[model samples]
Target: MTTITTNPFPVNHPLTFHRVAQPSPPTPFNSANSKHNTHPLTAYTYSTKHAEPKLSATSHEDQPLLFLLRQRKTEEAWLTYSQSTRLPGSTCLSRLVCQLSYQNTKEGFTRAQTIIQRLRDERQLHRLDANSLGLLAVSAVKAGHTLYATSIIKSMLRSGYLPHVKAWSAVVSRLAASGDDGPTEALRLFNSVIRRVRRVADPAIAADARPDTAAYNAVLNACANLGNTGKFLQLFDEMPEFDVKPDVLTYNIMIKLCARADRKDLLVFVLDRILDEGIDPCMTTFHSLLAAYVGFGDLETAEKMVQAMREGRRDLCRILKDSNWENSENADEVFVKLLPRSKISSDHDPPLLPKEYAPDSRIYTTLMKGYMKEGRVSDVVQMLEAMRHQRDSTSHPDHVTYTTVVSTLVKAGSMDRARQVLAEMARVGVPANRITYNILLKGYCQQLQLEKAKELVREMADDASIEPDVVSYNILIDGCILIDDSAGALAYFNEMRTRGIAPSKVSYTTLMKAFALTGQPKLAHKVFDEMLKDPRVKVDLVAWNMLVEGYSRLGLVEEAKKIIQNMKENDFYPDVATYGSLANGIALARKPGEALLLWNEVKERCGQKKVEDSSSSAPPLKPDEGLLDTLADICVRAAFFKKALEIVACMEENGIPPNKTKFTKIYVEMHSRMFTSKHASKARQDRRMERKRAAEAFKFWLGLPNSYYGSEWRLEPDDGDDYSTDSF
Candidate 1:
């Protein structure tokens, strides 16, 4: 075993724990006890097989095993019992072993055999004894390797050992599972066990319950499983008379027989008996219920059960994982079929509807939904094409499926491909749903193709077969708004209400966004009112962000605060969006202290715990990363240089570089503004500017224009007396 010492241990399973350091003899532990342990559960040690680093001599740390084994108290006892002693261990390993043995419950007794193989690899092969060997034989027999199982059994006999009656019960039970119920050969095996037990001495004979009775039950079940209804009935009739008290497994098999036979009447009959006997139906039982509901078209119930299985609400890892097919419409149904009906349930009847049971349609729709959710139009189309080839027997996909793909493509902003997919769907006789039409409408609206979008809308409305929902109307309204046609959006919103379709948050937000875009806050506020009036309308993050951003940009600080306060009242906590506005708006209003406070809050909320331990503080609000740079320029406009400098300092402290082109332009403007505001004489300023331009003039005089050189005025200069140095 690898030692468990050191900071990092490299091992797959950490259950093999050991100690790290040396100490005085192990003692009892208490809060006030000596400092000997690092953690209660943590163990560290070195490999016994290899030389390792020694523990530090200074620290007094005890090994965990010493304490666990009670070294000081039980040292002599352990030495006395050394040869016969079993090392103490946690029960965790025992539980793990039991769990490993139950890997395959339904497929036969192969579980024990599989564990033996693992044990053999782990060099623990000696763990296999008469009982385990018997289980291995049972697994082989049920796996249809009867010859191998026989060989194993013979080997047991040769070793002067055989499984007890209990082990014999397991072997006989597995043999009976192989459908070899031709005669009472199984009865002979049971009788053989009786005779052998009688021959054993009384002390050895008095072990666990007689394994012969277990063999009896196995034999009886074999008869039932073989479809010998007459024989099964005979056994059932004789079971009570034979004094065989049916165990849980025996009745479970009976329940299974009913479900497998698809004899619904017998199924229900067996269900009542199970309940009368007060037997609990596990996940396998509920799986059988799901199967029964499959042919009945109660998909909702089936889906509900499936959800329960998926969510781990039931102990179904053994039940569903082994039985249910992955990604199949009838996967849940198969699980149900394995189960027998139940009078009692683990959960209340859930209102889940399993979608259409058509495996092909269900799979196709599911993939399409996933693609739509991910905005992967291309993948959606590819999956649809494959489904079309399988089901339609044509070159292209069905219209409905194709339409779904096309609609998803449009939503994903793949307009060209969406149109292509649309053509293909139309070719395949798949009519589009409202969502499909909406995708095309939104795409056209974005491209400002009003005529095409309107045409499709009209087509949808004219068809009584197609019901236009809120999304359909919203798409058209959004298209209008995108093209700066707020009038069109307003008309569509009204048209939807008139048509008895309620406006969604999207409907209101689209109009609000349009108003904000046009710098019409009043109009936006009106839409906000309309949204508030509808109890069902809940504004999304995008809507609130738009209002906050728009109000901030206009420097309406008080109104922006009110919006934030309202959002808080509505229990909508401010995110980065609201904070950015708070920082920029306050900065723009020349309230640098307030701006600084808001900045601190943003950091405290977003970066307090983070930046304290962080390698660097918040990044300076980059023009690209944030819009607060506008507030920095506004500071220059408001003539608050000190406050603007403070903002720069904060940005720098946060590692933000304030390299503002706008601020530079404003600086130049500010200089000009200051001079002009002072009413400084232009000529007086001109004299100072003339002195500054002397060097530039000297360079210009040497590099005179070619045209000027050709000019007579430049070639023949006036008298030096007339052209003074100042004139030159």
Candidate 2:
């Protein structure tokens, strides 16, 4: 007998077997060996070499890590991973990183960064392949870590790894949509990708890394949003060089750029360019055109454009073209002539939209908003009804359209009708979102219906499943201010924070206004300090103005001035509202010299040749009638006639006609009897004479008779002797 030596299992293992060879030739069962053969040990033999036992890929070493990750026990999972003798497989490690990134928490992002850094330190970053890094970038973006996502993409590029288009494109798109230097960063990332493509030696890698049409669209959108017309043109010109073509979306973005730049004259030419490029116009194309017209407050042209769409007119461009550009005799001809030939073509061709674009709900709502802007309440309501009657489902009024109707009604003080519209929204099975509820809240608050506003808040939570956001709270706070309920404003402010709704800049400012209006300047200051400490809310000029108003309302002129000085040191120039509040404070405090100083500062700011002039370091201030009148009233009360005359002249220059009748009343009530008493000294007589001459000049401007005086008798010089104070 022979024994087989090969065995797949190790020695001493449970599955290990030791067996003698079977009989070489056929043999009958014998009783002597039957006992040994009873166990039926079948011998298995290998033809070549011994084979190793096959185990599951994820069953053994990665099981613990996978289990912890699956249970979301990331901390425990990392601990197990760190104590491991060897690193996990690339797929396992990549999954760990992805799971960490997907957590979307600060700790999760920090942990993910730590893992990547560990890999780099250990020279094991190669475990994470291109796909893995690309996924990480996308995950970071979803977590709101856009800058971190951008860094991940840059790392991929540096490693000669071409990330998926979705990864980099998403990063660029998110960055562009973000505020501040986001758009600039988006452009820089796009350029980096482009440069990376150029440096790649392999055609396959270059093609993979090359910015696609979507990437170009994203960066172009950034350019448009940044209002970089020159850069927009430059990037657009570069598209064709990279074998990328502008699609309908590209033209739509260009239309937005035109609107933002206020080059309304170029809007039609953009549509012409779209048709020229043979790109079929989408609904967004028409919407952009209509929105551009509406935003520029050219409702007449906007209505005409909408009418053209309703009539299915093919000559949309002709119907909506700027007449100022067509008429060569127009005064703006020189301005139009200076536009770039590419952006605005002088050729008056018959530019027509190739296809008809029927107006949708958005288009109708945009038109309604324009009507709302002009306070044309009836027109906005008619537009809403028109949307409802349309046969197309796309034209049916949705939540936004209904909201516009509500807004129009609210603006017209038709609160009862606005409430009915909300009911209509529910009847039509259209869900009113938080914005719709907030609008109603604001209207109720403005109307001083605090009870109704509070009821609406409850209804939002119970019936609509809509919780009050910061705006809702802000409106309620402002309503409290309107009703002089500072306590109620404080209650709403505190409730919003308790409900996990962080206070915004508007919220803080509105609350401050409540305290300020109620003569609680100290409380307003407390709120201002809290706003400064809040990292989520940015303290803007409005907030600063609110702080000043708070102190000014209490006649705290010194405190208000200190706040204004701080406002300036922070690079925020006092606007009309700021100065107006300060003027009120000065008037309340009865400080004439402070009013004089304020007038001087205001004149300096208002005296600039142009508000947009580059040489001016501070924004030009255009004093409103309220501010001017307040200062003038203060001057008249203090008998500063010369300063008051200068203020009135400024008012006339700015097209704000001075209230001569009101100023005359103030002069008669306060300063009419001034200099009537006899002066003892020659110097006092000369000073009084100087005041009398200035008062007479002011009187001349007011069209008052030279002989007019208050109830007291007039003081006249006797026979051209100026020093004589003779009462007539």
Indicate which candidate wins on lDDT. 2
Residue-wise lDDT of candidate 2 within 1-728, one digit each (tens)? 11111221122322222221221211111124433332111122232365433332554787788778667676787788878867776556765765666555667666666667666556667565455456667766876667668877776665445555667888999988887678999999988877766665554444445667888889989988998777777777787777888899988998888887877877777777777768889999888988998999988888888888888889887676654254333423322432333334455665677777888899989999999989999888888887888999999999999988888888888989998999999999998999889888989989889999999999999999988888889898889989899999999999998887778888998898888888888888899999988755568888899889989988899999999999989988999999999999998988889999999999989987554554757777888999999999888878788899999999999999999899888766655556555535677767677778888888777777653554324434333333222111
Error (Å) of candidate 1 at residue 359 is: 9.3
Measured on C-alpha atoms, candidate 2 has an lDDT of 0.75
TM-score of each: 0.38, 0.74
Residue 587 local lDDT, model 2: 89
Model 2 misplacement above 4 A? 1-95, 100-231, 238-244, 297-300, 322-325, 328-347, 374-386, 610-616, 687-692, 705-728
TM-score of 2: 0.74
In model 1, the number of clashes is: 15
lDDT of each: 0.50, 0.75
